[model samples]
Target: MTLKATKTWFLRLLPVVLFFICYYCSQIYFDSYGSSGKSPKTTVSLCDINSSQRKWSSLHLNTSRHPELFLKLEDFFWREHLSNHSLPYGIKGSELLLLKVLAVVTSYSMPGNVESSLDCRTCVVIGNSFTVKNSSLGEIINKYNVVIRLNDAPVRGFEEDVGNKTTLRLFYPESASYNPGKHNDPDTLLVLVPFKQQDLLWLKEILYNEKRVRKGFWKPPPQIWLGRFSQIRVLDPYFLHLTASNLLKIPLNPRRQQKPVHPTTGILAVFVALNYCDVVHLAGFGYPENRNQQQPIHYYGQDTMKSMKNSFHDLNLEARVLKRLEEQGVILHLHS
Candidate 1:
């Protein structure tokens, strides 16, 4: 070949080679830092890439295999039967009313399997404990594949400590946020943990925009819930049963004298995450170390530990179970 011809061929191939090199580098970059140059909002992190082989605790293995996370049409009759027997801390709504609400909300039921592009699915349960107020865990909490917040914990101004990314916010009617939009993302699932027949009634009224009921709830629920119906999910009563009976060792049907112990939203949220996540984490849990400590129970509210005396939850027992979970490698606590 002529020298001039050889030079022409080299020049033609140079552009093509450079294009391939740039494309390959770009792919590598996105894989590491994601498309937006940050950890992905809902996928395995680099540190947890190989976490699939890790052995989960017995608590996770026992409950994770169950397919139903939320109440569905199929379980209506069974739930109704259980409710008729005076089951404590379980939904006692009429079968007809319960069926109607389940039909609307269960359409958005969680998938039986954990959905993730990668093997390791990370989750964080953000509690309302005041300990998280200055923990500076916002960036860390936001990195998980799932961020589950409990009750009415506000995330607007506390984003610096409690990341604003919430995949699920679990609450009963009494604890539901008045302004859910300010605390939840556009796609956050509003999971209702019904403690009584009235709770389901309240949800039905809220979803259908029926006349608001000012009675039944210990405290008044939101008069108008602005969230979309598709964003709602009713937690399966089985979780409430499991958390109360197995985890907390509380009786399903307490006698009249026993002030009716039930699982708190924080611990219940952790149980939900265990079923759907590979590595579960907890933030802002634990109560004031002592009765006289004068520490606020919640991050945003001025209410202190004294307020817990009137509550149905036994916070001391919940704290112990959480500690055991941390020790067993089932979950990691984010706050000191």
Candidate 2:
């Protein structure tokens, strides 16, 4: 081709070259920016893909008759409460043996009850969904007696959308991180959801980093270490299973009930909040599919901009459950 022909071709591809240059530079810039800078270290390619597809047998959901299901059980994490009667599924033999030993090291301690418990109480469960962005719910959210936030959704920067007061923060080993200075509140209780014995093992490591301990089910990166948290509590597996079956209406396998879906942290938080407070409120939950299916998954990270749904947690169905409770005056469904 002649020089004139080559010049014309270069002009046509100029925008394409500039676009690639900008995209590459942005990735480099964002990759090293801040704490929400890089995605939480995970075995999965991404952090949100942390759900395990364990083939659990179906569990019955005939729990509406039991009002006591919401209250704390006796000797919760102290004993391996692995009996199938306590839970629909029995703890596997090896995990049972491990947790039985783990129980020796574990102790249950509740956060000292404040005067607020005796007062007329209202609690709110805040999720990390992007729907709450630009929502002026901060002032109203703070008015509640208790506010529970999930994982590492920061309030310092995004206080307007999510409230500043964090009474409780619920998370698990995979999703939880220890940032020393950010959430330095003695009042905020950090609750751990021990999905398995490995979770307990993992917590032992994070809280009190030991060398040459027996192997646990979960093996996160060696660099995983926790900062100071004022209070820490392990959730009894029975409580989560109870939530999955009863409040969520998940039925036993081979029965005409909702599938025994694993309750997400948000689902568990909703249950926990409802029991403690006279009325509960839920914010930033149930992926807003109608408005924007392509919005960022969490308020903190803008990397994964897409819908939040998975086979493991039926968030939509969970949302429906919350709505039903709202109609029954059990809770208030705070929407964006």
Candidate 3:
């Protein structure tokens, strides 16, 4: 209970305090410090699809036999598609109506027969991260014809305003499906990105449900958004079932291909837009490094450190692909 006793207690606590400091700093170092030894691929554009218009009826009217649509129609019972609303937000109504209008318009306006058709176009992938905050990247990303967004990362609420040209919502069957009032729309192409084989089976079941699907009794009517929403229209369904570790040619298996795996649902949506559109842009990615000191924003509304640790590898991979595309002169990589 004297000076010597106090000194002994202080000595014991000092090491513990130092250990905690070391751990916290280590996390910060890994999260903020750039990786060394490995070179980063230069981020660039992947394709260019010039914007144009075409006849809506011809483009949208004859969609009766599309295999994907038919297969999906027989699966999920078309529940989500039938209950669409017209609002700019929400999953069921006006949002979907607008998407149908855009799809019909896009379908009607066929691409001209040119070499550019084979080229990937520009697309904007939207995320709810805090990285783009106050950075003024919105105008830059809005240049793309297609804009893909994930859950509700409010543009107005955040610094980078979400553009009006939202083309799709990369959804999954289970917990990832669109929420009723979370500022989503039926017109937002319901891109069901399954992470497993079971997920796909579940989606198929939903599309085929008669009571759920508005017109599941027969083929979905042409020009109606219901069929397309229920149908899987994105890339290879199996591709979504794989993770970045397997897709990006990472060394999960020593004998597998070294090429990068396909992008995640969010990234794939951007690529799909690139495949069909002309220009692409990226926004709301990475971390601000000083997020805690700033306003309430999140890279994904999750713990920043945790999210970064999980996504760092994938983001690095995506950057590599973008850089490669840039090198090929597929598209421009704008930094803001």
Candidate achieving the largest TM-score: 1
Candidate of highest lDDT: 1
Task: Give the higher-lDDT candidate: 1 or 3.
Answer: 1
lDDT of 1 by residue, 1-336 (tens): 999999999999999999999999999987776645254343235435234335344555454345357777778676432544322345554567678797777475653233535466788899888889888889888888788998888988998899889888898888898778888888788888877877888888887779988898788888987777888888777777777877788887778887777888888888777766777878898788766647787889799877776788888888888888887777878753
lDDT of each: 0.76, 0.58, 0.43
Query: Which pairs clash inside model 2?
Result: 58-253, 59-252, 59-253, 60-252
- Candidate 3, residue 5: the lDDT equals 98
**Each prediction's TM-score against the native?**
0.79, 0.64, 0.46
Instruction: Write one digit per residue (lDDT tens) for candidate 3, span 78-189.
Output: 3433422211111222233223323432232222232234454346677655655566565545555456776445444443555544555565443343342234433455
TM accuracy, model 2: 0.64
Model 1: how far residue 78 lies from native, Å:
3.4
lDDT of 2 by residue, 272-318 (tens): 76545554567887565645656666767773434334345677788
Of 2 and 3, the candidate ahead on TM-score is 2
